[model samples]
Target: MVEIKIALVGQPNVGKSHLINSISGATLHVGNFSGVTVEKKEVEFERDGYRLKLIDLPGTYSLHPYTPEERVTKEFLLNGEYDLILNVVDSNQLQKNLTFSWQIADLNKPMVIAFNMYDEYSKRGGEIDTEKFFKLTNIRAQNVSAKENFGLEELFKKVIKTYQEQNKPRIYYSEIIEEEIENVREKIKDCRFDKRFVAIRLLEDDEDIYKIVHEKPWFVELLPQLNESKQIIKNEYDEDDLKEIFFEERLALSKGIISQVAKIAKRETLSEKIDKILIHPVLGLPIFLFVMWLLFQATFNLGAAPMDYIASVFDSISNFVGKFLPDGILKDAIINGVIPAIGAVVMFLPNILILFLGINLMEQTGYMARAAYVMDGILKRFGLQGRAFIPLVSGFGCSVPAYMAARTLKNPKDRLITMLIIGFMSCGARLPIYVLLVSAFFAPEVQGNVMFAIYIGGALVGLIVAKILRIVLFKGEPEPFVMELPKYRFPKIKALLFDLWIKTKTYLKKAGVFIALASLAVWFLSSFPRENIVKEYSLKIAHVKSEVKKEELKEEMRKKILENSYIARIGKIMEPITKPLDLSWREDVALLSGLAAKETVVSTMAVLYGGNSSNSKKLIEIIRNSLPFTAAVAMIIVVMFYSPCVAAMSTFYAEVPQWVWRIFYTIYPNVFAYFAALLAVSLIKLFS
Candidate 1:
């Protein structure tokens, strides 16, 4: 079979990733692009005797990149290896989407257009004459709905046909621009790219393209003519910015071609109708909060349903293993260390999944954009644009991806400020700690409300910190926020399940491996150096006559062993700092282990408090009885504001190269967390 490599390209919200997911019999590989945190998705599948490999490029608006993700797309198109370009367009927004389509046409590559979301368009009485479009631009087009999975096979057929024919875009621009392109094209000699593409990019003053052709043998001669061509275009268009001129040129071409090839439905969309109330200036923020409150309520209540059953199952496993393994370090580690610790974290999986599902539903249904729109006004008051809201909200899921998502912010200062405060967003990994404490301290009816309060409170404080940072460190007015809200559509079951499956897999893997290993380490530290304690306890039990008193002495012996264990020593060193918060050594250890991952805080507690039994149900009771109400609130406060896990921290370090900012990012959150915890403890004491 002949092999063809296709680069899948599109503007944002045009269903690019969905299209990839819809491909039948495709094998996918996901990884970060070289030296960048932006995700790269590639798929390979065979169709009709041809092997097709598709590299899904990041969604971008134009060749002139405005964001880091956009630059990644542009650089790949200019330099990455690919045999054909498959540009997906939102059929409902042809005017806007086609502007970027025309820009890609200038690359002069073998191209095919997949008018994605065609089902939505067709339902609304829209039509696109692909034959006319092909005749107009010499690039084949297909109307495909990646979600509905219609017209996809035909789209790929066109893709393969375009590759077979070596077809390239025959699009032309305004006469004046064409004349300039011709002039610059003639001067270009033995260049790697199509001369027309080079000429156009030069006219647009593309810095990346300039770097490429600056060292050419004909550069000295081409320089003056290139300048003259730019001047001619500027004079003819009556615009000083040649880039603007080129943008308008493509935009005009988009309008001209779209008029002939498309019949756009002029009726108001359902999205607009929904946005009327959902994004109302006066009511939007409250509605958003209510929605979040419901989500957390469901996350806590619904997720709690399976906890006892999951706990029972794990308890059975631990008991079975205990019966089989002889009493020693191995058995204690397996029973107390690995089983219960993993069980404690795994018990919270349902909560994490419910939370993820809620967020995914908002995103897939296109309400996420409206959320940003609603949040933009409040964010601006806090020295952040609405765009910063996306990453900050993403920080609720996980900080690693949230930091990566900050790439969408074009301003370096905005990106930095947003990332710095993301830690305060209370990611899902931290949810278990909150749920555990909230369940232990608060009444059942109020637990969900407390969970919601935790999230909203963190976000509010983060915004306040953002405003403070703007005044003291990076002072500037926030950039204007402009976003296109996608048409509302029902989320496909397959896609939603795929997302949930990935989340479940990731959470399980972390629990099985990372948490288990951390628990083992905790177990070793808390279980060892027990010879002296065990001997003393044996003598004391031997001297006691009553069996009940003997058991009491045994329990005392266990606590004494834990007090002097290696991990306890470490926690003691930090106790001076936490003493004001009314936190004990065990709570201190749990918080410190959380620096590795928030989930481990719960796992560490299970290992330390559950002692001999290792049952989550018992662990919770022990915690409620062991810790004071003030201490519980202080623990929650610290977890909310403290530095994120090591993975998140390292990701921040990688994304930010400046050591000064990195150091500040690392140190400030912990210091802030300590003070916050102390204040919470003091206030509770004063009020009570």
Candidate 2:
């Protein structure tokens, strides 16, 4: 049972990540640190005879008790049971850094202040009396550069010392704050927390924190009185408002501390002065578009060659096995099912990794916050705050984690709306659909561009739908905004790999299982003998006369397919029901059965028609060449806007409660997808 944990805490964009990378000599993940998508990262290293575990917490300006991230930071320091907390701070911004140090100070956890960016501090003419910092705070503080890998030996030594220290001092708030703390302490004698931290949260009116107070036996009598006192105090000061009060105080305090400890010679920093072109509306949108265009370009085009090569490799393997093995069910299983299933998943890896690298690039450079800032006005009309841009961007990596990112939004309604639209953002999971669709529907002109357009198409439609839902469903003014825009910096290479690893893990976890199982299921369905209607008639037609007549009959077999297969029988049962969808039995069967996992149609086509190779393309050409254009539209629209597969449905239900209004979750968008595709198909025919 030998184990130890250390925590890293800092204001946003200090060298917290830099320090971790230097200390562990391992890649440390860097992202906007907040929400449940947020968590402390732990990496273990053997440094000088002791196993060192470093946990990186979410960034915050202060723990003066507001915002989910601040709460998460505070709770982890107290709950994560770390032996030491590395209070990472900007050497150039000493005062604002102190607020986090002071807050962790209250937790009384053993900690070492790894004063980061000493070079930045010195260049800015900042001089820190590290000894004075310790005298005021009673915690060990050292100036070190996470960027240069300087002072890590001393940093580790202090870390080891903090771990071994038996007499670590417990700190508290001013007597005024402590008196109320004592009352909460006596009441929470039965509850848990660093008695002092709970008191501060109670003072600041944390809704969840106060609820915990009322549950304590001794506090039940005092809860009402305590709440009354808080209200009385709230009336006296604008300071205790529910939003950003702690943040504002931290900013003010940090600015004050910066002047005393850090110096700036008034030379303009690189990014702070870049507002003229980058943030200007005409120029800004175009630049943002260009940047993202490059991102999607790199993700698709750069990855496509690799993607095609991988697809080709899987195709070759399946064919090689089929040619070598005897004609039997086992060969069918190996060639048709197993290979395609693995291919379905393997093709996505390149795109997922590249897109994750792009998003991580944005997050690390602090462009993410800027993107949100620039888009806020436009995003507001859709029932989102400026910050919703972060989650939407994250969806390109994976939607489940993107959904988790929604918790960062303060408004619950907006968070739910973000989650709902996120799945439509064209994740790497959707890329296989694009690969199949573009290859089938059009020539290879601008293949990456076409795939990129499809991604934008889904995002555009998702946003429009979200705006409509917002207007008709949850109409209200969105909350005001105050987002931290950390100064842009070079994205660390290690952080990029760490991000790639995280997304790769998520992609496989969510989509891999279904693709694998669906491959086998589809092969099983394909291996069975054709059923009563189509099989009977296909057999009946076997004895036909002329070569010309046989060719004509073969062409007509698509009709026999409708009359006779097991899939056909299932479709006919629901045909009268789906006619508004302009769906023929072929489309209907594919739609109904494939609803559980949308990719099933792709696998099913390969199995039902014959080999999944370019052979799958011939099946599509046959359908398109015969089935009315409207039918093709119905198929595309149905899959695009339909109820997401079972996984998305389960997530929606789990995240959202079952209010009567929840019927829209089950019905509205689905019927909309059905008819939209149907109408588009009809319009195409009518125009033709």
Candidate 3:
């Protein structure tokens, strides 16, 4: 079968990714573009006896790159080899989206326009004449609703037809701009780019294009004419910046085309109605907070039932292993170290899924954008833009992707500040730790609220840090907030389940390898240097007639062995430093292991506390009875404010290259967390 490579392009939140996900039999592969940190996603599928490959370019506002993601998109479109351009536009916001459409259309590539979200558009009494759009722009158009999987087959057919026909766009700007384009076009003698596109870019004073043209032999000769053409356009438009003039021209043209081809059926948009309350200046923040609280409440309460079942299953497995294997290192390792550690991490799967599900729903329903809108004013006061909220919220899922999501912020300072504080958002890996600690220390009635408070408190602290960074490191006004609020729609259940499955699979995969190995290593440190303490205690317990006396003897032996183990020695060395925070040796080990991965914190605790036992209740009971309440609060605060895992640190390194900033990013969070824990312990002790 023949293969057609199409580049998918659009503005952010315009259903570009949703369209790619909607296609049948399509498999998406994500990677980075050459020499750039921006993510590149490609979707491949067999359609109509042809293999269609769609390269989902980063969502960019225009060819004039602003952010790193936009630069990647622009570079790919200008230089990368693709059979055709598949420009996806939001049908509801044609004029604004089509302004970008016109920019890409200027490339004169074979193209097809997909009016995505057509279902929502038509429901609002809006109608588009595709034939009329074709007549106006000379580009084939399809009204596609990727959410509903409507008109997708027809859209692909058009894509194939456009590829086969090799039809270039016939879009034209105003006559005056065209005259200048032609005037500069003639002087461009030898260049790889289309003469028309090059001429227009030259007129707009695009530095990237200017550099390319300047390297040519014809550049010195053409420079004079380029100046003349730019002057003429500037004089004609009464504007100093030809780029702004061209932008206005394109905007005017987009409006003109929309007026000619689109029929407006005036009706109240669902998004508008929902935004009245959800984005209301006063009620919005409170509503967002309540929704977040409810999300955590459901995650903890609903997940508790399944958590018990999973714990019981692990217990049965441990019991079965103990019955079959002889008392040896292998049996002890499996029962005491591996099984309980894995069980502790696995039991929180339901909570992770519920949390991700809520996040996915908010994103799919378009409420995520409104959330940014609702928080923009408050964020601005903290010297961050509204766009930072997306990445900050995504940090709750994982810091790796959240770091990548910071690409949407055009300003470098804004992006850097956002990346710096993402650790404070408390990702899913940290959820198990929070849940474990909360359940052990807090009352059942307030466990969910405590979890909620940890997350919100971290976010609050992040904002304060952002404010300080802006004042100290990056002193400037926050960038202007401009974002497209996509129309609200019912989330597809299939897509939601698929996303949740991916999250669950990723979590399990990480647990199986990273957490398992970390647990084994931790077990080695905590269980080794075989002392005679266990044997001596066993003899004493064997002689004790009273059941309580024998149980107490066993507990004493367990504590003695743990205290003398290698991990305990390591923890002891650091005890003085962490003493103010009131962290026990076991907690110090767990927190240190968390630097590797947050999930391992819980795994380390499980292996340390449960030791040779499969009963989870015993572990929780031990912690509840032994650990002081103030220390528990301090530990939670430390986890909330500390630097993320190694994987997240690597991602941050990839995103940021400055050595000074990278070093600051690494050291400051831990220092802040230590001090915060210290303060928390002190306050709690005073109040108690």
Which candidate leads the pack in lDDT?
Answer: 1
Candidates' RMSD to native: 5.3, 6.4, 5.6
| Per-residue alpha-carbon lDDT of candidate 1 for residues 87-117, written as tens digits (9 for 90 to 100) | 9999988988889988898888999999998
Per-residue lDDT tens digits for candidate 2, residues 36-148, read 53445666777667777777777776655356667778667655667777788776656666766666665666778877878666776666766665655566778898777
Backbone clashes counted, model 1: 0
Candidate order by TM-score, decreasing, is 1, 3, 2
- Candidate 3 lDDT (Cα, whole model)? 0.82
Q: Please tell me which model should have the higher lDDT, number 2 or number 3.
A: 3
Q: After superposition, how far is residue 21 of candidate 3 from its true place, in Å?
A: 3.5
Q: After aligning candidate 1 to the native by TM-score, how far in Å is the CA of 137 from where it should be?
A: 1.0
Off by over 4 Å in 1: 385-460, 469-477, 506-513, 535-547, 575-640, 643-666, 675-688
Clash pairs for candidate 2: 95-257, 96-254, 124-263, 126-263, 533-564, 534-564
- What would the TM-scores of all predictions be? 0.82, 0.76, 0.79
Order by lDDT, highest first: 1, 3, 2
Summed over model 3, clashes come to: 0
Native RMSD of candidate 1 (Å): 5.3
